[model samples]
Target: MNRGKLNGVAGTTGALCAVVLLGNVMAPDAHAQNSVTLYGVVDAGVTYTSNAGGSNQYALTSGNMGANRWGLRGSEDLGGGLSTIFTLESGFTIANGKFGQNGTFFGRQAFVGLSGSWGAVTLGRQYASSSQFVGPLASGSSWAAPGMGYGTHPADLDNLNSTNRINNSIKFASANYNGLTFGGLYSLGGVAGDFSRNQIYSLAIGYTQGPVKLALGYLNVRNPNYSFWGNKANDSTTASNITSPVIAGYASANTQQVIAAGTSYAIGSATLGAVYSNVRFSGLGATPVAGLSSTAAAYRGSATFNNGELNAKYQVSPALLVGAAFDYMKGNGAGQGGVIYRQFNLGADYFLSKATDFYAVAVFQNASGVDSRGVRAVAAITGATPSTSSSQTVVTAGIRHLF
Candidate 1:
C-alpha cells in the first residue's frame, strides 16, 4: 500500500509540472524581443600648461579629448516598427577613479523613451539640441579627437563642445529624410510657483549630402546661472555658480541666448570646417551676486560675445590624421570694456586598432582688453586653470580605448 501511495504522488507531481511548463510556453509576452548592451571608453594623458595661475605645471589628466565613461543601452521591440529604448551613462575621472559631473552616478545621461520610423522622443537629463546637432562640425568634437576639450573656443563660451547638459529635459529627434534631420529640446525648471524659472529650450537642424554638411542651432535659457551652470537643486537667485572667469560677471543675468552655425566640406583626403556663434546675457542686475566677481556690479544691461572658428584636417594615411584650427572671440557691453581672445590648435592621431588610438594636441591662446571682472583680461582655457597673464599654452599626449 505504501508503494502504491508513492507512485500516485509521483504521478500527480509530474502532471502539475507539465501544466506549468505548458502555461509558460503559451504566454504571448514570453517571446518578446529585447537586448541590452554595455559600452565604455577609457582615456588618459599627461599634460603641460604654460602660465597656469602664474606657474607652469605638468600633470596627469583624464579626458584630454573625450570624456571617460561607461554606459548601458537597452532596447525592446514592441513590434510594428516601434521600439522602447533607454540609456544610462556614467562619467568618471580615471586618474583617481572618482565620479565626474559633481559625483552624480549617471551624470552623463539617463533617459528612456520610444522610437519609430518617424523619430524618437526621450525624457531625462540630456545634451541640448545645439550640442547634439552642430557640435560635430566644430573641430573640438571632430578630427581634433583625443584633445577636443583643449581645442574648444575660449572657456567653451558657445557650448559647441558640450560643456553642459540639461536636466529634466524632453527631447525630440526626427528620422533622417534624404540626408536632412532636425531636433529640439525643452527643460523644465521644476521650481515651485514659477513655470519659467530656470527653464531652457533649444532647436537644431542639420543636413549632410555626400561631402558637404551643414548645421544651425539656437538655445535660450531663463536664469542662466541657475539653469545651465548650477546643479539642478540650486535655486538661490542671490548666489552664483559661474566659475569660469571668462563670463563670471554675467552670473546675475536673467536670461541667456545663443545662436550658432557650422559647415564642413570634404575634398579627397582633406576636410575643411567653419563655425560661428553669438552669445548674449541680458537683463543684468545692478548688483553682483554674493561671492561672485565684483565686476557684476558694473553691469545693468546686456553682454554679448561673438565667436568664429575655422579648421582643417587631412588624412595622412589609413591610420594617421592631422588637423589645425584657429578661433577668435570678442566680448562687448555690460561694462566689459571690450575683450578679445585669439586661439590656435594643432593635433594628430594614430590608430593602433579599430578600438584604440594615440593622440597629441597643442593649444595657444592670447587675451586682451578688459574682462568681465573689470580688470585686465587673462587667458582662460577650457578644463584648465586660468592664466595669471594674457597668454597661455597647453600640450597633451594621450591614449584612448573603446569597448
Candidate 2:
C-alpha cells in the first residue's frame, strides 16, 4: 500500500520462492516438538466508485474484502511453561504483484518475543496498543483482512484501521486473568541527542466474558509525521490506501493523541457493537521548505476529531453472513471549524468453503463544511479517491481464499 516504487522484478514467483525457502528452513522438530506454521490469504475484486477525482470509475483491486498476505509464525518451547515466538508477515497487491506497506518485505509485522504464564514481551516493529485492542471491536475490523475503510472513522484519525505501525518498540501483553487483560507499548525515536524527537507510548485494557467484549485504549505520539512509522517528513514513498483529503495535510503535527473505547454483545445469531474515539492533533505544521520557521511554520495550532460508530452482523445460515455499520465524525480546530463526515457500510459474504468465500460490499459517505485546503469538504472513502462533491459511493465484489 505504500507509494514506493514497485519492484517489478520481484513478482509473485519471488514471493512464492521465499515462502518455500522459509518453510523448509523452519521445518518442525519432531523430538523437540517445536513448531512453525506458514499461512496466507489472497483476495481480489472488481470495484466501482461514484466519484474519484471527478470521474466515475471501475477497476480491479486487491484487498477489498481482506488484505492479500502471507506470513510465517513459529514458536520454540523452552520448558517450564516458557516459549519463544516470532512472526513475519508481508502484504502485497495481486493486481500487479507489488509489495505493500512502503515496499517492506515484512511490512505487516515483524516481531520476536518471549511468553510465559505472566505475559508476553515482544520487540520489533509491531502494532500500536490502540491498534491491538481497540481496532478489533470496531466495525471496520469485523469484515476481515484489509478491513473496509468505510467503517473506519473519517481518515482513521484514531488508528482504528491499523494505518500505522511502530518501529523500535517494546510491547508487553499480559496473560488473560479471568477474562481480563491489559498491555502497553513504548517506541524509541532512535534519534540520539533528542530522546523525545519521535517517541510513542500507548496503553490498553480489555475484558471478555461470555458473549460480551469491551476495551479501552489510549495512544500518544510525538512528532507523528516522523514517529508513527519512522518515516521522514514529506516522504511520498510511505503512502498507503489512506490518502484522504481529510488528513493529507495535517500529518506534520508536534503531537497526536487518541483515546478510544468499544463494546460488543452477542444475542442470538446477531452481534451488535458500538465504538467511540477522540483524537487530538496539537501544533500541526507544514513541511519545511525554503527558509521555513522550523517545522511548525504554517501551523494550524491544534485540532480535534471525535467519532462514533454503531454496527451489527447476523449469521442467517452456515454459509452466509451479513453486516452493516454507520459512522460519524465531528472535527473542530483552529482551521477546521465545522467539518463533519457521515458514512454507511453494508456487506455480505457467502462461504464457498472453510477457507474461501465470495463477498460484496457497498459504502456511501457525505462530507460537510470546509477541509484543510479551504475547499468544500468532499466525501473521501478510505480506499478510494476523494469526490468533487459532498457525497460519494463505492461498491465491490470480491473473492478470498486462505492457505
Every candidate's lDDT: 0.83, 0.79
* Cα error, candidate 2, residue 189 (Å): 0.2
Q: Which regions of candidate 2 deviate over 4 angstroms? A: 1-33, 229-242, 286-297
Q: Kindly list the per-residue Cα lDDT of model 2 for residues 26-131, writing each as its tens digit.
A: 8645235376566778889998999999999999988777788877677779999999888888888889998877687788889999999999999998998877
Clashing pairs in 2: 1-100, 1-101, 66-145, 67-145, 67-146
TM-score of 2: 0.88
Please list the residue runs of candidate 1 whose C-alpha ends up more than 4 Å from where it truly belongs after superposition.
1-33, 145-148, 232-238, 286-288
Provide the TM-score for each candidate, comma-separated: 0.90, 0.88
Question: How accurate locally is residue 189 in candidate 2, as Cα lDDT from 0 to 100?
Answer: 83
